[model samples]
Structures are given as C-alpha cells and as structure tokens.
Target chain A: MANVRLSSIKKSFGKTDVLHGISLDVASGEFISLLGASGCGKTTLLRIVAGLESVTAGGVEIEGVDVTRLPPEKRDIAMMFQSYALLPHLSVSENVRFPLRMRGIGSREEQAEKVAAALETVQLDHLADRRPRQLSGGQQQRVALARAIVSRPKVLLLDEPLSNLDARLREDMQVELIEIHQRLGLTTIFVTHDQEEALSLSDRIVLLNGGKIEQEGTPAEIYSQPETGFASNFIGSANLLPAEIIDGETGPVAKFSDGQTLQLALEVSARGPVTIALRQEDLSLDANGDGPKAKVRTRVFLGARNRYVLGLAGEPLRALTANDVEFSAGQSVGLSIDPQRIRVLPR
Target chain B: MNDRTESLLLALPGLLLLVLAFFMPIGQMLILSVSGPDGVTLSHFVRFLSDPFYLGILWRTVRLSLVITIICAAIGFPLAYIMARVGPKLRLWLVVMVILPLMTSVVVRTFGWMVLLSRSGMIPEMLRDMGLVGRSFALMQTEAAIVIGMVQVLLPFMTLSILGVITRIDGRLEEAARTMGCSFLQSFRTVVLPLALPGIVAGSLLCFTLSASSFVTPNLLGGTRIQVLAASIYKSVTQTPDWPFAAAQAVILFAGILLVLVPYIKMTGPKDG
Candidate 1:
C-alpha cells in the first residue's frame, strides 16, 4: 500500500475550471473518500490520481515518487471504474490476469496462481473461464475488483464502484469492500457522492464542494463538528436556520427569528449571527413541551419512523420521530433537542 | 386461407423478384457456361482453365484484390475507430471525407490517380527529386497501380462498415482495459479489434468482392498491357465477341468468390464464435 499526494492540482476544460487548485494527501493504507455531489470534480480528482486524466497544474506523487508525467501503465496503481470496465473479450480469469500480464508481474504459472487467488478473494473462483458478459452485475463487479487487486498495486482508486448496484447488492458490496480493505490494507481512494457510503466506507472523508475542499475529518468528527453551512447540511442533513447568539445567564444561546431560543452547548464560541444546524434525527417532537412550537406541515410515513415537516417561524424544518408517536398534518408540536446536538456555524 | 399461407402470399412478390432478377441470370449463366456451338458441353470451362494466359489473368486478379482488401482494412480499422470516437461534427466530416472518392465516377477517380502516378506526375517527380527512384521510374499500367486505385475506391466501404459496429461498441470497454493496465494501442487490439471483427469481416467481404469484379479503374489505369480477370472477361465478350467463353469465365469468378464467401458467412453466424 502507498500514500498518494496531490499538490495544488487544477483542471480546466476550455476556460471552465473543474478542479480549482485543490491539494490533498492520502495516508498509507488509509481509506480516504473524496465525497461530493455530481459535477463537483471528485471523479476528476480520482481520474487524475489514476493518470486517466492530465493535471492542469500540480504534482501527483505516489509512495514519495513523483509520477505526474507517467502514463497509467507505468504507475503502480489500479482503478475500478463505475461501469466495472471488465474486458468483454477476455474470460474472467484472463481479465483478472490482465494487470499481471501487462505489468509482467510473474511467470505464467505464477500469474495463473495469483489470478486464482484473487478470484477466490472475491468469491468468484468458479467463474474463472466464463466471459464477463456471462456474469451477473454483482459478479462482474467482483471480477473487476479481482482484476484491480490481482496485481497488488500500491494505490487502489475506485470511482463510484458501488453506485451502479441495486440497494441490497450495494450494501453487500459495501461490506465486501470493507472486508477486502481490512484484509489487504490497500491505500484506497474512493470517489462517491453518497454521504452515508463515504462515511461508512472511508477512514477519512474529504468533502469537496465546487472543486475545493470544504472539510476533511473522520466520519464522527465531520458529522458532529461540521464547520460550514455546506458541510453541516451535506454531511448529516442538518437543518439550517439563521439565528443570533446572545449571552444568557449560564451560557450563550441561539435565538431564532421567532423569539424561541435554544441554549447553546458550552463549546460553541460564537457571539454574532450564526446558522444553527440541527439534524433531522437529533430533534425530538412532542405535543406537550416547553420549546419552539411548530406546525406540522407534512408527515411522511417511513417504515420505522415518521418524518414530520415542521413550519418553524415561517421556515420549513424536518424531524424524524418514532412511528409510535404519531403527529398529524397541521398539528402544533414542540420541537426539542439536546443542546449538545446543535451545530453552530458562523453565517 | 391460414396465417402461413397468408405470409407466403405476402412474400410472393419478393420471392418472384429474387427468382426473376437474380436466379434467372445465374441459371442462364450456368447453362451458358456449358453450352457449345453444337450442344451443352464443358469445352468453354475446360478451355479457359487450360490456357496459361487466362490462368495468369485470374491469378493476378485474385492477388491484386487480396492486396487491395488488406490495405483497405489496415487503414480502415484505425480510421473507423477514430471516426467512431470523435464528436458528431468531426465524425460527420470524416465520414464525408472517406466517402467523397466513392461519390465521383470510378473512371474520373482512376484518371486522377493516373495524373498523380504517371512518370511526369507529382508522385514520381517527388520520388525522383528525393533520390528515392530513377528518372525512368513510373507507377502506371502496373499491378501496384491497380491495387492503389482499388484500395482508394474500396476504403470507404470498409471504413463505414467497421464504423457502424465500432460506434455501437461500449466505449467503456476501452476505458476498462486502460484501467486494467492496457495501453491505448493494446486496448485497441484486445478490446476494439475483437468487438469490431464482424464489421471487419463484412467490410473485407465487400472490399474483396468489389475489387475482384470491378473493371473500370483497372481497365483505365492498368491499360491493355495488364489485364485482370474482369478485364479479360470484357475482352472475351466485347472484343472477341465470344459470349460462351465470357459466360464460362464469369461463372468461374462467381464460383470462386462464393467458395470463399460461404465459409466466411458461416464464420459470421449468430453464435459467439
């Protein structure tokens, strides 16, 4: 496994810049995720690391060696594409053996042995001779994984590899991905738009917004201490409400526009106007409570919980309450939350 | 009265047209190939096969056609791949460029080649100026001239046929190959070439057949000194007024092409192989 570094990387397509001078460092054997919405340059960054794309201005170093000018074949890396670009002409075994063959990794027998072992790792040993077209989607994904890992490249790049699968299959593949990473400890850079997938899969999530790094931290740290409005909203579906921070008798409290106030946790050192980020799941709804009274605008019936859209001071805020505690549309309810759960970001 | 009969009845016009327009000429050729001054005989076929001059012409025709088809394919594959991958505007321009030669008359195109390839033409002049050849060197009235003219005319057919298939191929396959550690050229060979084989085979069939049967370019460029099988057949029918011998030679050419084409068609069957 190897660490990958990108310093001041910039990419432009005919006057419009996609990646605007972004820099990142991936630690060795660490699962780092570049998480962003579509068209945010996460996939482009992954492609640049794989050498599939040229860097407009920057250096790409892998394992402490500068490889900005090297072609993909010369780089000691493997990338699993979103489409699972298995060679349709080659059988599964041959597809797995391609990198080994191209890199001249081992003897014929040795390559075959590695191919067999890699296939076994993906639990696809029985499909050795079958063509990729003959396999199912999940099986093809496994074959692609097998092909990527067969050579044991220093860095593994995955570009939304699980985004194509169905929900259940995606979950299964996620588990498989975690298991494989744990077993091999490959320095993997996964590019995905799904926040939950990034949070669940990566050791560190680098949140990208408009070709720039918005935040970078562990999942819990990012979820709990999102520094910007974008990060808070994108990461944990935090409801943002403009509010002013005022010093109370004990500590600072965030006062919403409607005169209702939520006491801030001791750690938030903000005095001026700020945006209060309260997660949908973190806020509790009760008909009888001493808190901000909001009218239930809508109630969506989820399997295990009811999501109630509340109108708070003329702004819409959503909350997830347990299914047992039912709330009807247009009903007045008090929205309460643990002050520690509130994330205060400077406006 | 029933669905089967109704379907057959609906197909009757097409079947009759095939019989009348296609099979009738072939049947007459088959009969005429054996007919003699007195009665039906094998004299015409036997005579053509026995003559060294005729055999040489036949061999030259097949060899030149093979060379032309190979050259067309060698250039067409990459050209078609590029045309397939490029943007729509660029691809349209490339397609038009490839087919422009075909839009002109074959005789006109051949004369253009004659102007470029003659001793005093630009090609030979450049060669002489570059010290690549002697002052007496010429490219006209030769098999090479025939092959060149034929390849130039047939290249569009080969390229278009392959382009139709290559464009339909999943482009992601090539990207996949690249991520699998394949160089661009390696990806072309391992991914694009195999997927485009059906089109290649089809284009080859068209190139070979059209090159084999065409007489205008070869007749104009190769002149009387060099005669291909089609030119020879024209000589038999028009110059000598030997209808039976021409029919026999035509039958031989047709049968030889079919002999190669039948197995090729079988190879291009619906099975994956």
Candidate 2:
C-alpha cells in the first residue's frame, strides 16, 4: 500500500475549469471517497491520481515518489471502470488474471492460483471458465473487481463501479468491497455520486462542488455538523430557510422572513441574517402543537414511513414522520424541531 | 394466403431471376467445360493442369493474392483502429479518404499507378534522384506492381469492414487494460487485436477473393508476361478461342478460392462454446 498526495491539482478542458487547485492526501491503506454529483470533477481527480489524466497544474506523489509525469501502466495502479470494462474475448479466469499477466507479476501457476483466489473472494469461482458476456451484470462487476485486486497493486481506483448494479446487488457489492478492503488493506480511491455509498465506504468523504472541495471530513462530522448550507443541502438534502438571528434578551432566536420566531441553541453566537437547515427526520408534525404553524401540502406514503410536504413561512419543507402519524393536505400543522438539531449558517 | 406461401410468392420474382439469369449460365458453363470434340471429356481440364505454363499462371495468381491480402490487412487494421478511436467528424473524413480510391473507376486508378510506377514516372525518377535504385530499375510490369495495384484497389474493402467492427468495441476496455498495467501497444495487441479478429477475417476474405479474381489491374500493370488466373482465363476465351479451356480454368479458380476459404472460415469462424 502507498500514500497518495495530490498537490493543488487544477484540471481544465479548453477554457472551462473542472478541478480548480484542489489538493488532497490519502494515507497508506486508507479508503477515500471523492463524492459529488456528475460533472463535479470527482472522476477527473481520481483519473489524475491513477495517471489516466494529466493535471493542468499539480504534482501527484505516490509512496513519496513524484509520479506526476508517469503513465497509468507505470504507476502500479488498477482501476475498475463503472462499465466493468471486462474483456469480452477473455474468459472469467483470464480476465481476472489480466493485470497479473500484463504486469508479469508471477509465474503461470502462481498467477492462476491468485486469479482463483480473487474470483473466490467475489464468490464467482464457479463461473471462472465462462466468458464475460455469458455472465449477468453483477457477475461481470465481480469479475472486474477480481481483475483489479489480482495484481495486488499499490493502489486501487474504483470509478462508480457499483452504480450500475441494482440496489440489492449494490449493497452486496458494497459489503463485499468493505470486506475486501479490510482483508487486503489496499489504498483505495473510490469516486461516486451516491451519498450513502460514500458514507458507508470512505474513511473520509471529500464532497466536491463547482470544481473545488466543499467539505472533507468523517461521515458523522460532515453529516451531523455541516459547516455550509451547500453541505447541509447536499449531504442529507436538508431544508434551508432564510432567517434572521437576533439577540432576543434570552439567547438567540431565529426570525423567519414570514415573522415566525424559533428558539436557538443558547451557546449560539451569530446575530445576523442566516440560513436554518433542518433535517427531514428532525421535524415533528402535529395537528396543533406549541411551534410555528405550517400548511400541509401533501403526505407521501413510503410504506414504513410517511413523508409530509409542508409550506412553512412561505418556503417549502419536508418532514419524515411515522406511518401512523399523518396529516391531510392544506391542513394547518404545527412543525417542531429541537434547537440542537438545527444548523445555522451564514446567509 | 398462409405465411409460407405468402413469403414464397413475394420471393417468386427473385427466384425466377436467379434460375434464369444465374443457374442457366452456370449449367451451360459446366457442360461447356466438360465438352470435347465429340463427347463429354476431361481433356481441357487435364491439358490445363498438365501444362507448366498454366500451372505458373495459377501459382502467380495465388501468390499475388496472398501478398495483396496480407499487405491490405497490415495497413487496414491500424488505419481502421485509428478511425474508430478518433472523433466522429475526423473519423468521417478518414473513412472518406480510405474509400476515395474505391470511388474511382478501377481502370483509372490502375492507370494512375502506371503513371507513377513506370520507368520514366515520378516515383522511379525520385528513386533515381535519391540514389535508391539503378537507372534501369522499373516498378511496372512485375509481381510487385500487381501487388501494389491490387492492394490499393482492395484496401477500402478491408478498411471499411474492419472499421465497422472496431467502432463497436467499447473503448473503455483499452483504458481498463492500461490501468491493469498494459502499455498502449500491449493493450492493442492483447485486447483490441483479438476482439477485431472477425473484422480482420472478413477483410482478408474480401481482399483475397477480389485480388485473386482481378483481371484489369494485373493485366494492365503486370503486363503480358505475368499472367494471373483471370488474365489467363480471358486470354483463353478471346485470344485462343478456347471456350472449354477457359471454362475449365474458371472452374479451377472457383475451386481454388473455395479450398483456401473453407479452412480459413473454419479456423476463424464463430465457436458455439
């Protein structure tokens, strides 16, 4: 395993910048996820580390060796493409052994053994002789994973590899991925857009937006305590409302534009206009209660849970409630959230 | 009408045309090939097979065809691969450039080569200037001339067939190979080449058959001495007035192509397992 350090990587296509002076360091044997929506430069950053793309201005050092100018083949890194990218002409075993065979890692017998072991890790040893085309989508993904790890590369780069599978298969593969990473201890860089996958997989999540790192922290730190409105919005898709924080003699109270006041955490220091982020699960809905009143727009049934869309202080809000607790549309409902759960950010 | 009868009725005109225009002439050719002075005989076949001169013509035809096909493949594969990988607009231009020779008349294209390859032509003149060949060295009227001419005439067929296949190959395969420690050339050889075999096989079949049966290019460029099978067949019919002999040579050429193709097709053909 190797530690990768990307220093101020800037990537651009013509005049449009994709990654603007972004720097990151991944320690040895650490799993780092570059998480963002499409076109957020997550894949480009991963490609730069893998040597698949040249940085416009940056230095990539792996194992303390400056490999900025090296090609992917010389970097000793294996990447599993989102498409699986298995060689259709090769059988499953041969596909798994491709990296080993290409890099001349071991003798024929040794390579064969390693390939078999890799396939076994993915529970696909039975289909070893089958061509990639003959296998199902999930099976092909496993073959790709096997090929990636067979070489025992210094680093493994995965580009949204699990996104192509169905939900059940994606969960299975994610669990498999965690087990494989723990067992092998390979320095892995996973690029994905799925927030849940990033939360479950990465040792640290680097959220990207507009070609720059928006936030980078542990999942709990990034999720529960978002530093910016974008972080709150992108992470849990929390509701954001423009509000004013005024020193209301006791501590701080948030005054909504529609003139509804809500208590804030006592230790809060900010005393100007700000944005309030409320997690959907944090808000409690009632027919009548001691909180700001909201008009129920709709209630969506989600089998195990109910999601209520509400208009609060002229802004739309969503709150998750137990399936048994419900409210009809256009009805006035009181919405209450604990002051501790509210995230106040500068407007 | 029922489905089968309806299909047959729809195909009736084509079937009638095939019977009258294709099968009848072939039947007449078969009868003519076997006809002797009085009765059906094998003299024409035996006579052609026994003659060393006729055997030499057949050898030259097969050899030149193989050489032409191999050359076309060697050039066409890389060109087609480049065309496949390039952007759509550039690929379109490359396809047009590759097909430009085919768009021209074969006689015109052959004459263009003749002008360049003749003793006093620009190519030989440049060779003289560069001190690469002797003053007496000429490119025209040789096996090399025929091979060159035929390669040009058939490269489009080879390139287009291969291009159709290469473009369908997922480019991500090569990128994945690279990350797996394969150099660009290694990836092309190990992954791209094997996947493109169907196209290569198809192109080789086209180039070989077309070059083998070629008459104008070889006849015009290789001159009278270097007689390929098709030119020999033409000579038999028009020059010698040997209808049976020409028919026998045509049959031999057909059999020769089949003999080469059957094993080739079997070797590269799709496998079930």
TM-scores for every candidate against the unseen true structure: 0.95, 0.98
lDDT per residue (tens digit) for residues B1-273 in model 1: 999999999999999999999999999988888988799899998998999989999899899989999999999999999999999999999999999997999888999999999989999899999999987888999888998899999999999999999998988778767766779999888889999999999999999999999999999889999999899989998889998899999999999899879988998887663
Model 2, which residues run further than 4 Å from truth?
A: none
DockQ of each: 0.59, 0.83
lDDT of 2 at B181: 87
Model 2: lDDT to the true structure: 0.92
Report the lDDT of model 1 for residue A130. 93
TM-score of chain A of each: 0.97, 0.98
> Each model's C-alpha lDDT?
0.91, 0.92
**Which candidate leads the pack in DockQ?**
2
Question: Compared to the true structure, candidate 1 yields what TM-score?
Answer: 0.95
Q: Write the per-residue lDDT of candidate 2 for residues A220-316, one digit (tens) a residue.
A: 9999999999889989889999999998866899998888888899989998899999999999987878788889999899989999999988999
